[model samples]
Target: MNFAEKYLSIRKHTEQLCGPLQTEDYVVQPVADVSPPKWHLGHTTWFFETFILKPFSSNYQIYNEDYNFVFNSYYETVGNRVIRTDRGNLSRPSVSDIYQYRSYVDEAMVKFLSNEIKDDVNELLVLGFNHEQQHQELLLTDIKYILGNNPLFPVYSEFKSEILNLPSAAQKLLNIQAGVYEIGFNGDGFCFDNELNRHKVYLNDFAISSSLVSNHDFIEFIADGGYSNFNFWHAEGWDWVKSNHIKAPMYWHKIDGKWFNYTLQGLKPVNDEHSVTHISYYEAYAYASWKGMRLPTEFEWEIAAKHFNWGERWEWTESAYLPYPGFSKAPGAIGEYNGKFMVNQKVLRGASIATPEAHSRITYRNFFHPHLRWQYTGIRLAK
Candidate 1:
């Protein structure tokens, strides 16, 4: 597909994901990390308007002068934006207003793409496509969180569930010989700046699990007092567990001595065959430690990724989210994309069931605070 075709398809899918939601669901933000669904709709539209049409399209008209303040997210280079925590408080924009804004901006984007596009403009266009795709994944997870936490235990959609039916494979370790290996995005296709400077790293011989940890395995961890034992956790992780009173993964509930978790389909019995998800990096690490294993480093995960089936959950890695060698930020607001969030975060390899098609690549580096488990995160053991 051409750029315009790809652009429209991606844009349409974003709206389709929101089709299952009630109007009230659009404005709910249960946590600071997850943006309101309406905010995501407006923010993604603002991206195209702010970056492409404003600078490149001479005939383009500004949608709303006030929208810059409403939708701008973390782009200090652009201007001030609604504070993160206050996004849910933005009930004035209204879901109707945001959808209209999307329609308005999307029309301009379609027109702009019809003209002769320069190489630089094309680059930003691709970024706009991906930026929305990132939020598309977030939309699903955020909607799940919003509904899962409700008193009614609302179901987002009966058709959407993370649990997948696949033939059970025997769990074993895939051995990697100790040697120097190359990592990072080596393709000519578009990749975030963080995946640049494809470079070499030396590794000790290690073996990584061929399959993700299942719900049954995590239940065993809990039965063996994994959460209760401080010896199995890092100092910070143990504190996180105690302060938050975390036992199982997010959306998990123990009732009548049985495990149940909230999925998009509403509350259901925990499937032992499905991979255990909604796991924090700390939980993943503690579980590995309890099993006398470890989570693979980002580089190790990337090197060994081909040997396993992923795309089930965002697998947490034992790697700090640091810049690769010779990595530099792009000029202006775009530069702020991934460079600013490198600290106090852990890297997660692979993609989740919520991830969009064509969005997950082997070299993609997804990072989040260690305590977060709202996303479809899971564990993979290495030693």
Candidate 2:
């Protein structure tokens, strides 16, 4: 598809994902890491206005003067904006109002794209779509969090996940003949700045599991007092576990010795065959340690990814989220996109089921705090 067509298609998918939510569902943010569904809707629209319309569109009037202040997230180069924690408390910009704002911005964006745009503008437009797609994954996870944490446990939708029946014996570690391998995006397609600057790194031979760690495997760790044991955890992770009294993955609970967890279809029995998800990096690390293994580094993971199936969950890696060699950030607000987040966070490789179509690449680097498990995160073992 052409850039304009792809842009419109992506935008429409975001709206469609929100179809099951009630008016009330769009405004609440259950946690600080997650933005409100309404906020995501507006903030993505604001991206086009702040980056594209205001700069490129001829005489483009601001949709709502106050929106820039409310929706501008972490763009210090733009102007002072709302703090991250304050996003959930916003109520004046009702869900309906946010939808109107999205419509206005979408109209302007379509008109701007109608002309023969320059290559630079085309690049920005693609980035905007990718940005929105990233938020699309967040919207789903945030929605799941909001409902999963609620006392009522309301069902988000009637969607049932397609079950994958992999033979239990198929789960084995593949010995990787690691050597000097090139990693990073090199094609003409759009990629985040963080995935650029292709380079080579030598890796000692190692082995990675052929499939993701299943819930049954994680349940073994849990049954063996995984949370109670500190030896399997990092210092900060151990503290996080004790202080929070975390016994299992987020959304998991044991009732009368039967394990249950929340899914998009609402509360359901934990599926043993499914890959365990909603696990924090700490949990993933501890689980790997318990097996006398470790999570693969980002480079190791990338080199071995072609040999195993991924894209079910964002697999945690041992690598820190740092820039590549010869990496440089662009000037201005756009530069702040991924460069500023390259510290003190762990990198995750692969994509989750929540990721939008065509949104993930082998070089894509997903990062989050080691303690947060709100996303679809899982563990992959390496030794």
Candidate 3:
């Protein structure tokens, strides 16, 4: 597909994901981390209008002057925006209004793409495509969070079973030889700025698991008193466990004697064969420690990714989220994408089931605070 076609397709897919939701479902934000569905719809549209149409399309008319205040996320250079936690508090600019905003901006984007685009404009357009794709993944997971938290355990759709039944591979470890290995994005295709400055790093010999940690594997940890044992956890992790009373991974519920998980299809029995997901970095580390193994560093994951199956869940790595050598921020608001959140976050090295197609690569770096587990996060062992 050409530029305009790809743009339209991605935009349409975002809307399609919301097809199963009720109007009330679009406004609920159960937690501070999860944005309401309506906010995602409007914020993504605001991205295109703010970055591309306003700056490039001289003849384009602004949809609503106040939208920037309502939808702007964290771009300090883009002026004021609705505070993150208060997004759900606003009942104005209803869901229908956001859809209309998306339609209006999409029409403008299509018209702008019809002309021969300058190289810089084309670059920004690609970034806009990726920004929306990132939100698309967040949109699905956020929707899951909103519904999963409901006391009724509402089913979002009938598509949950298939995601849990990913093709399983024989569990084993692939050994890698110690040497200086090159890492980071080397391709000419689109990649986020954080993947730049491809460089070499010397690594000692190590072995990484070929398969992700399964639900059965984590259940064993729980049965062995993984959460109750302080030796298996970091000081902060153990503190987190006690403070939150976290026993199993998020969304896991223990009925009379059986374990069930909340999926998009609502609550269902925990499937032993499925990969364990929605785990925080702390839990991943504690589980690895309990097994006498460790999580692989991001560099180790990239070097060995080719030998194993990934993309099932966002595998937590041992590396912290930091810029690569020679990494620098771009000028203006666009530069605010990845550089600001470098500290106090763990890097996750693979894509999740909710990630959009063509949006992930071996070098793509995903980061989250150690305590956050709302995303499809899992664990892999290394030694």
lDDT of 3 at 371: 97
Report every candidate's CA lDDT. Answer: 0.93, 0.91, 0.94
Candidate 1 segments whose C-alpha is farther than 4 A from its true place: 164-167
What RMSD does each model have against the real structure? 0.9, 1.4, 1.0
TM-score for each candidate, following the candidate numbering: 0.99, 0.97, 0.99
User: Could you give candidate 2's per-residue lDDT for residues 2-49 as a string of tens digits?
Assistant: 766877898899999899999888888877998899999999999989
- lDDT score, candidate 2: 0.91
Q: What is the lDDT of residue 286 in candidate 3?
A: 100
Q: Provide the lDDT at 268 for model 2.
A: 89
- Sorting all predicted structures by lDDT, with the top scorer first, yields 3, 1, 2
Instruction: Give Cα distance to truth, residue 4, candidate 3, Å.
Output: 1.0
Q: Which whole-number lDDT from 0 to 100 does residue 228 have in model 2?
A: 97
What's the residue-level lDDT of 248 in candidate 2? 95
lDDT of 3 at 105: 98
| CA lDDT for candidate 1 | 0.93
